[model samples]
Target: MGEQQNPFRTGGIARGHRFADREREVARIGQGLREAGGKLLVYGPRRMGKTSAIARALDLEQARGGTVARADLSTLSSLADMADVVLREVTRAVAAGKGFDDFLAEILKRVNIGFSVKQDASTGVPIPQVDVSMRSKPLEEQKLAVGEVFDAIDGMAAEHGIVIGLVLDEFQEIHRFEENFSEWNLRHIIEQHENVGYVLAGSKRSLIDRMLEADGAFYRMFDKLTVGPIAEDYLVPWMEERLAPLGDGAGEASERIVALAGERTHDRMRLARHTWFRAQQAGRSGRGAVDHAFAGLVEEDADEFLRQWVHLTVPQQNVLRAVSMKVKGLSTADTLQRFALKNSPTAVQAAQVLVERELLFQRPGEKGYFFDNPYFEAWVRERTAIDLGMEPPE
Candidate 1:
């Protein structure tokens, strides 16, 4: 058999059973779009596949003949920057099929971004070059420039009679824009356009919620969805499918590795892959099955993961350790106060930071919080010197 497949996949969408579990989510979003031109806000903790799920949904939409445009808001520094990226993607989507050249020319003219056609040396097809001169405008004027771009996109969608779906990934970063530029643009475009649907995807749940809640400008403006971890039931089957070519014990070994990785399914899959690769290496040394030796290999593979995490601040590390050791409930103020100074705010601050970073979540209807990734939590517990027997430091 070939190299064993890893069950833990951290980045990107997993195909087959890994992706199959998200069908309901995809269908729900798709149904919302069909029912009414709607805006979608997708939120989840880090490594939960929020971006991958949206990408998969967009792929499905495009396959079904709907036009899709994607913009990564993580790199965008201002409202204008995001608008430029979104506009560029919208134009490209418009120019994807036949008459694309004319379509590009029209949208460019509408947005005041000059479009020129240049012949490609290889394909001899005329490529559209958009002169995006709006980048240099003053911050105040930049909003108007962005408005024009959105208007142009709406115009193009109407003229072409095609459904335009725009996806903004890591959208929480848009808050960095001056004057809350990101939120302003989202509110403006989404409110004005009927044909253009948007999917705002981010891993920061709290921030995204604030943006969509009734108190904010985006209140009731978007349909909200939370992308959670892959279902536990699908893990073993997915691993077995990926590791099938590696022979008889591959499935069982993958399961064991997944068990080791714990609730961080993505990490589990990744560790499984590393274990499989190491097992193959061991096979060359006449080692047949992935046994205790393969387990050692998994630890070696996870060394970097361990190293990166260990570098966190003491309080951060302590908080993680606490969560791991006490997974049944949330971390309490009392627990934190034990490690922190009397009446000191450091404990509360630390807990907030962990939640903001998506490392822990507040337990619903409870006082404590829960770690999002059990494996990472366990690793922290095993590595930290903090005694599980003692009360939190005060």
Candidate 2:
């Protein structure tokens, strides 16, 4: 076949027509940002497209003449880092509508924080760079700086008459900075800023839930939205449509692809992309194409998967096998015996560790846990034996 653009993509924040059917989620986020004093918490497991939906919503909000600022809080190391992200993104968004020189003067006049601003060569929008040396400052001073940044954003929104909204992606990571203190401080600051809307998004479901419990600081502080797997009814037809122009037998190919890809959005797109490539090479499309693609992907990750498998304890490995095979009642007698676990408690304990490592996950009301990565589960199925092998000698 000739060189043709693959109609599929994975990873990163998908937008425009490249995004999946997340109309409801996008609309909810947009509405939250448009509302006065709106605080929304959007969360779900990794690779479910929450970030993409939020990105699309932010674009729509900005297009409607709303000012939007987004910062990913996942990788920050200190309170000072969080402050810098908020300051940088807010100033960048503000500068998009005004002269960089004038904006800097206005911000310096209003807020006490120091910043160096420069205009981007391509977009000409001003970018604010914060001092990284603040990492060495006292923790209290850093925390105060974060509050000052939020106060400045609120003041800026009021003065400009712009509907300003902010998104802090992976907001749960804030807890790492100061335990529950960060949550309380954030809630207090957010409550005082009635002019600015906030969206706190994260992929760590368990931690997020704990933060929203009644005793937690964020309880009743924001509206909740959960992004789940795309419905098969929508995904199947959508995949088929995208594949139709590329080759014949798209219908059969799409069904097999989605079924094999399981429920994750990125996984489906990746599998679809690989299957399409295989089909194009062979001049055909079918379940065989999907199988070939799946096998190749599994093989490609064999070394990394083996590295992961070797580190697991014998009980952890057994628990993984049980979950991979969809064994119900993980702590049941039959399950313990079949998986070679010492007892119910041992099985439960090992599974909990796996859950914390993000190798496995459970839905809100589901009784049994599941493999977060379907490909890993497939690897376990194809390569490993069900019987728990004896632990290696010490």
Candidate 3:
């Protein structure tokens, strides 16, 4: 097998052998997409592979004779942009498996917006291209254009017997597009559609919670699903198997990689990929190799870490240092003195700010906060070890 490349995929969507766990989640999403009028809200912390799982589910739905479309809301600037994405992707998905002439006859007639057909470069198939002129319109006009796009799709789905699934990844970004009315307006438009299953995926838990609050526009509109870490039992062995193709000591090294990388899927895979590279250089996948690889990563990101560090206040830096060191009772007299925090109130305020900046996060119903990036935590410990009179992390 032409020298297997790095099996640990850290970039883009993890697919094929690179993807691990989340079988149940994928199945649930596929089932939701297959049914008519299914609404689901899938969310998780950043880098948790929620997007990857959703993509896999969409692929499966498409294979099972369902029309599926996915668009990342984070990439768009306005509702009109979103409407264009939906119009292009939905039409592409619907027309992909059907006869070109049939799609033009059935779908094009229902769509009221102006668009043109562009031929695919490789497949030679025709692709629907939305008119860019819509972008120049007023925000209100753009909103109506978006609503019209969805209205047309809903009409098409009802007229033709078809199961359609629409996935809006990073759906919470709509708040930035039209803060005052976008949420309720979208909810209203979606409620009228009876044939398209909708899956809204997001990473920011704070904004998602606000949207689902009692007084919020999207309250109880979706069935909630939160993706968490893959089980270590599955992950470690999977990592070991992936690493085994590279060199020796895969078992122990995979364990260390997962432990050091913490629970996030992308983070773990990124470290694992680097660890594989280290193994290639050192001729073995061992604990020492993993540690060396991690230190290299810390060093590589040192400048960016320093930039983030310099932006915080002194007390915020101290609180971060404390959190990095895993110090308990951060506000206790001894802990504050050890970390050089000003006072209990000061430390509390600083930590809150760190959480707001996403430099730190506390698990739900959990007492203490944690570094969102474990590698950054390592950098902090290494940089402050001498002053703090502690040994640098290995």
lDDT of 1 by residue, 265-339 (tens): 466656665655655565421123434544454455467647757666777766666666563322345655544
Q: List ranges where model 2 is wrong by over 4 Å.
A: 97-101, 179-181, 386-394
lDDT of 3 at 3: 51
Per-prediction TM-score: 0.78, 0.93, 0.94
For model 3, the stretches where C-alpha displacement exceeds 4 angstroms are: 98-108, 392-394
**Model 2 TM-score (2 dp):** 0.93
User: Could you report the Cα RMSD, in angstroms, for every candidate shown?
Assistant: 5.0, 3.6, 2.1
Q: How does each model score on lDDT?
A: 0.63, 0.81, 0.83
Q: Note the residue pairs that clash in candidate 2.
A: none
lDDT of 1 at 167: 78
Best by lDDT: 3
| Cα shift from native, residue 307, model 1 (Å) | 8.1
- Higher-TM-score candidate of 1 and 3: 3
Candidates ranked, most accurate by TM-score first:
3, 2, 1
Model 1 spans with C-alpha error above 4 angstroms: 2-10, 13-20, 32-36, 97-101, 113-136, 178-180, 248-258, 262-265, 282-317, 327-346, 372-379, 386-394
lDDT of 3 by residue, 118-179 (tens): 88776675667667887777788878878888887777877787767889889888888765
